[model samples]
Each structure stands twice: as C-alpha cells, then as structure tokens.
Target: MNAAGFNPSERHPDLEMLDGYWSDGNQARLPINGVPECFIDLDPSHGTLTLSVPADGPEPDLARFRSIELATYTDGGDVWWEIRIQVDDSLHEAYSLLTRIADLVQLENQAVAVATYQALEAYRLLLASRGGMSDEQQTGLYGELLVLEHLLRTLSPELIVPAWMGPAKEEHDVALPDVHYEVKSTKGEHRRHMISGTQQLEPLRGVPLWLVSIQLTPTTPDAGRSLIDLVAVVRGLSGHRLPRVNELLVSAGWRDRDADLYDAHLTLRSKPRAYLIDLSFPALTDARIAQVVPSASLVRDVSYRVDVTQLDFAGPPSPMDAFVEIPEEKTE
Candidate 1:
C-alpha cells in the first residue's frame, strides 16, 4: 500500500527505500527486520545519491538497495520520478557517470534541429527576394511556392526520389525523370497566354514530373523571365511527342526563326549565351526504343556555358531595373 497527496516535510511516497549496513558512502545489506517502508534525506544537488547505513545491520540485505525509487517535486507541486537500480558495488559508480552523458547527447540533438530551422528560414527569404516576390500587395505569389519547395526538400528528402523507387502513382507518371516539383506563380488577368512550354523531349519511361501553375496581378508588370517556371515545364514533359517539343520552344521564343524544328541534332540555347546549362536524357531499353521509332537514335546529353556580363542591358532605362522603383512625380 502507498500514500498519495503532498507532504511538506515528508519525502514523496514514490521514492525507493534502501536498507542495509552503512559505510562511508555505501549500503551493505538490509536490516534483519526487513526493508523499511520509507527513508528520508536531503535532495542531492548533483551526481549519485550517497546513502549510509550502519555496518552492524543484522547482516543487512544488500538486495534492498536495488528496490529504491527517488522522486522530486516542484514548489508548484509537479512531481518527477527517478529509478535507482543497484548493481555490484564496483559497477555503480561507472553507471552513474554514463547516465549524465546520455542526457547531454539528447540536448545536443535538440540544439541542432533548432539551428537548422533558422538557417532554412533565412534561405527561404533569399529565394523570395531573388524571385522578385518579396512585396506583399504586388501578388508575388510564387515566392511562397518556392519557400514551400525548399522547406519540403530540407525536411523530407525522400519525396523527390525517382518513380522506380516506388514513388506514389500520381507523381510517377509526370514528365521529367530526375526532378519532381510543382510551381505556383502570379501573372496578369489581361494576359491571354501567360504560361510558356518547354523544348525538351519527354522521357519515354520512368521520368520524374513536376506541375506548375501561375496567377497574375496588375502589380506584376515585369514578371516575365521564368527560370523556376522553366524547371517546372521541363519536368512535366515526360512521354510527350517529340514534335511537340519544337512547337513549345518555338512559341516560347527559345529558337531562332530559321532554327531547324526539334531536330535531335539542333543545339538548344539558353538566353544571353552566358549561363551554364546541362541537359539529362532518360535511358531507353532496346525494346522501348523500338516501340517509339524503329530507327530513332538516342538523344545525346547537352551542355552549354554562357557569359551574361558581356551582354549590355540595352537602353538607358533597363527592363530588369524597372521593378526596382515606381514612377515618382516631380513637385513644382
């Protein structure tokens, strides 16, 4: 039987009671009269709890040392418990030392998670500013989507794995093979054709897919260049017809008017000819290629390096700088 309720001076009933022969700082055995129901002592400020029992116990029972449970209570009355298990006298001191070390490890892991979250938040803000979505009333909506993508990638790396690894069915059938993403951005209501397509060939099988949609607002007057948008478009092109690639790129102004249409040999160019570009093509098994085109050659990988600093912004009023400020009227 045990007692409940708080006792100001009395030790908590949950504490383990040890009875034995006491030495300088040890317990030898239980008293002949059996273990005591309760024991009292000042709470320890640190490390092991040192208890002393008289060495003359009626050949005290050391086993009683293993049954003790220590408890603590806050001034506000919340109770906490600690278990005390006895081992050979030689091992007790080492075990006590290890208990404190384990606690330190848990504290370190908590600190790591907190620091990572802060860094990730800062990166999110940087991406929003780079995408020109930092203004609130201007409907820079894509910033939020970019933030979400960064968050998901940082928190859950497995969500972006290829479909061959047993990814969910809905996500597996999309266009690109190595990247999976969804894009949401803002556009203008007056713009009839806001979304642009891609020039990349869709993977014949097992390609990753990404879906992107854009919303427009009047404040977004210069939200034209879509680098992130292009990423989404390419990822969604898996399994699309080869001819469709040329049509999409031609409509998007990616190729010159005289450029050959979607020829496997035609070099794809990114604007300004200054940025580095790389393309990944999906591998096709012999049977798969035979089904698509009996004599079609595999698409070779592509790479490009462009230097944009050489290109002039063109005109005293730069298009890229227009969003930096609104028109100001001169006072008389």
Candidate 2:
C-alpha cells in the first residue's frame, strides 16, 4: 500500500508499517522523517494529520498558530488531538522540515509540529545554548531575521550559512563564500548599534565585510507587524523557500505557538544602511583593545555601541550587491 511513494534515504521502523494503517480507515501512528518517538498519523480518506498524546503529555497552547487545524478525541478519558491538514507537496515539505526539527529537540509535547516550528526558528537564530533568552534579546533577534529575509528577497537566491553557524564568534553575522555581512538592528530612535567583540567589525585582508543596520518602530494596533505576521505571510507565499528563514526566526526566539506573546509591532523607519567596516569605521578592534587594557589582556568579551547618526558620509555607504532598499519608511 505504498501509494504516494516518497523515498527516504533510510526507512524508519514506524514508516515501514505506515501502509498497514490504511486497513483501519481511521488512523495509526508512524515516526517518519522526524524524531523516533514523534508519530504522525494520516487519514487519507479524510485528508487529516494527527499527533496523539497520552493524558499527561505536555500540551502547548496553539491558539496563535493559525495554520493548525485541531480536532479532539478521547480514548478512555485520555485526550488527544488530530491537528490535521490537507497539504500539498510544498506544505508537506514544510511539515517534514518541522518534523525533523522536532526530532532534533526531542520534543515531549502533543504540539510536536508547532514546537517543531519553534525549534526550527530557534536553530536559525543560533540560540541553541540552554536556558531562555530575554524578550529584548528575542526582539533584537527577530529584527536580525527580518533583515536576513529582506536580504534574501533582495539578493539572488543562494545557499547562505548563517553567522551563528560559523566557528564560535565569527566576525560577521552572515557568510556567503566571497563576502560577509554583519547585520545590526535597533528599535531606538537614535542610530545607535552594538557590535559584539572587537573582531566582529574588523575587516579581513581580502574579503569584504559589510555592516547592515536595520531599525524598526514599535508595533501599533493600527499599523506595524509582529514576528508572526512576517512568518505567516512569508511561509504562506514562499513555501519551500521559507525553511531557511524559518530557522533564523526560531533562533531569534520565535515559536509558532507563542506568536501572540510578542505584542510589539515594528515598522522599519528608514532604509537599512550598509557600510564597509574598514579602517575608517568607528569600532573597538583587537589592536585597539590591546593598547587600552591596563594589563593589555585580550578583551575577548568586548562589546561596544557606536552612534553613526550624524557622521557626514562623503557620499553614501559603500555599495553592496542587492542589499535591501527601503521603499518608504513608515513614521507613526
């Protein structure tokens, strides 16, 4: 009964028995592409997908993850949900990606798919370290992700390695073989931005390291968008093109279920400025830190903020290939 034939590199035991469920015409569990314990049961006749859990399983609030279609069932008073959906190949790809992410996190909740979405976003933002991140840091991370997504849309499509994935504390936020991009984002009115570590903005000999500044206004009831709004619109539109950005969002402390928790709205008030961080740029480099330290001990934990507000640029920031351009800055 292997009807829809999708070949995995290797088959999981659960998937091996997937077709057997068809006989019941109800549903059965199979841990397919994701975690060994994550079972997704499908009812072809009804076109539904479900992840059942025992009464004690952690149940995450999913009221905000709008794409989910929920159905409840009780087996001897133990509650479960069929978070079903009729998915096409593209949507199915998204599901598979989420499933793999959930597997990696070893999720223990009934909202496995939703949690997977959050995990993927977390991975993208590079917050794999244990413990929770602050809301302000999360907001800042979201801003970084928005800049990444905006860059992808503006630049040519190519596989890009996120800054967090590089060897610990890489200089730039994003690396693309030839050039590097360091993304800085702020919510404040002033052009103040923080550069972590002296090495971050310090340029290498040959390769170009460009600094991108993104600023957003606060969210408002009448206008502005939340992280959820950005994710929903992009996922709904881009389909397969979204998984990459989704990872960044998750890394930035985004969870599909917690979308509503982020009540803040953000409007980009100005065009993201891209400048070449060369010798002329204002920053605390390793060379400079050594001279300033009393013992000249390596200041590995150095982080400083620079105000580029009134710096009179001879012309404009250095040219970058396909960096995002602001159509119009919204002023509320």
Candidate 3:
C-alpha cells in the first residue's frame, strides 16, 4: 500500500501511464523552464526531483529535514543539486516544498545564494525549526571538532566520543585517559582566547593539562569548508561510534535540520599550536589567586583573556602523545 491509500493495482488508470516510462531506473525532464536543469528521478521507493544549479555558482545549503534530503555533487563540467523525498507518507508535503524551492531558484533576478536562502527559509517554516548557533558557538565548535578529529586518529573508537566532554559541560573540552585539553579558537592576529573561569585552565591531580589554540580566518567559499561540512567529515570518520558522536553533537546544541542556517565558511589561519599548562604557564588559577589575595574565597566568576603568542612551554612534537607515558629513546 502507498501513502495514497491504494495498492499498486488499484492506482488510478491515468497514473498508470507513468508506470512503463518512469519505473525501472528512468527519469524525465520536468516542464520547469529555467536556466537550471530539473528532472524527475524515478526509483524503486519513491519519486525525486534533481535540481542542477547549472554552473559553479553558490552551492545549496545541505539541510536535513524529517521528510526530505538535500545534497549536491559535481558532474563532468557542472555542479548539480538534488532534493529527494525520504518519507512515503509525507509525499504531498515534500512535493510542495520541492516545487516551491524550484520556483525560487529558477527566477532570473535572484542570485543563487539568495535563492538558496529563501528555499531553506521555506523549509524551516514548514518543518520543525530551531534557532541557529551563534558566531562564537560556531567557531568554538569548529575548533573542538578539529581536536576531536585529531583524537580519533590516536584513541580507540569507543574512547573517542566519551573523551569529548565539551558538550557535557566538563571543565575541559576533551578529557582523555591520560591528559585533559582545553580547546580554544580565535580569529585575531594574536594567540589569545577568552577564559570563562579558573577551572578551565586548572590541571587535574596527577594529570597534565594542555591548551590547544586554533586560529581561523574568513575565506572565500571556494577555499574553505562550512561548519556543516566539517561535521560531515567527523561523522564519516566516526566509524562505529557514529551514534555516540551524534548524541554529543545534539547535546552541544547542534541539529542536522539546522545545518542550512550556517553558511559562513572559514579556513585555518595557521596550524593548531599546543602549549602545556604547567607552573610557569601564564594563567590565573585558584592557587595563583590564593597566593596574592588573603581571601581568595571571596572572589567569584573570574573571567579574563590570555595571550599565548610568546609562550615558551610547548607540548610534545606529536600532540597526541601529550601527557601519555612514552619510553625514553635508548642512545648507544
């Protein structure tokens, strides 16, 4: 039975005209007249409309909806975008959404990005919607994700997601078995980051704490990847821990359905720099404040910024080995 409440044999006679031509891996160009190419993609499960944006113009926002999926790919000499319905019961709603999107993108006066924005706005209006991440959150999440990706290479799949503690409101962004890391991101020329409280840089008992700083600069779309694209990369590399990672993402206030709302792309200003936070490291911890003030208990919510551009204390060459016990190399 289909969503229309009819079995295949009971399908209307007029609709039967599409059976031989559209079924069995076939497609037909839609009557939509525009600069972009549009087609009806027929498949075993349901019908799909593939909208090719024609040239190397602005890419479509890859927003994941409950009933549909939007994606793009490069074909031969041109870039192509497609939207497909995923739910059988919501076919009517999906068709209406896609057609409206088609109409928006096909207008001669609208820029591709503007068209895409309008289409995504339509999607949010019709589906379950949530507010998007702030600029600060986006940058911070990007840095944490880069560190998470780095950890994925060194830690076991089961241990990776559990180690990412940022979403859980832990003192550190990443708490591995051997070391804890405070990840920070900034767009300024100096290696400076805002610290919320003393606990952020405080080292754990008998454990080492390191701070990883990532600098990001705005760049053209052609040269950079959006936050959503980075998220997709992390998901692809998660292997068996995909579900756990997704849960962490949700706890961090990110949902796939809201991916379209973030379009700003950025590139790395420089490779990430890691510094070991030890006795000489420049930071105002509880112990440091206690040394100067007789009543350190009276102070609260200590927030400040630190510039580490000239920090001499550096981590292991391979940051993955930070705080992890490594046997000393034998010399003859």
List clash counts for every candidate, in order: 24, 9, 0
**Residue-wise lDDT of candidate 3 within 1-332, one digit each (tens)?**
32323231221122344455445545554445565655445453445534445543575555545545666777786676666654233433444455555565665456555665665565565454335667888899988988787777766668878888998888999887778889899988988999988899998876788888888998989999888888988898799889989988877778676787667889889766777888888888898999999899899999999998776535443556543233346699
Which candidate ranks first by TM-score, i.e. highest? 3
The residue pairs found clashing in candidate 2 are: 121-250, 121-251, 122-250, 122-251, 124-247, 124-248, 125-251, 218-265, 219-265
What is the per-residue lDDT of model 2 for residues 135-184, given as tens digits with 9 covering 90 to 100?
A: 65755665655655555554543443243332234567777666677777
Prediction 3 TM-score vs. true: 0.57
lDDT of 3 at 226: 85
Instruction: Give the candidates in order of TM-score, highest first.
Output: 3, 2, 1
C-alpha root-mean-square deviation, candidate 1: 24.6
After superposition, the stretches of candidate 2 with alpha carbons farther than 4 Å from their true spots are 1-133, 160-169, 219-222, 233-241, 313-332
Q: Model-by-model lDDT, in order? A: 0.27, 0.55, 0.69
Instruction: Write one digit per residue (lDDT tens) for candidate 1, span 1-332.
Output: 11112121222212233212122344332212112111223222222332222221122222222223233343345332223322222222322222222222233332222432332243333222222212331222232223233333333223322222111213222222344322323343321111122222222344333222234333231534233443243334423332443343333333232122211111112111111112222223344455777464553333222222332222112221221122245599
Q: Extract clashing residue pairs from model 3.
A: none
Model 1 global lDDT (CA atoms, 0 to 1): 0.27
| Highest lDDT against the true fold, candidate | 3
Error of 1 at 206 (Å): 3.5
State the lDDT at 96 in candidate 2.
45
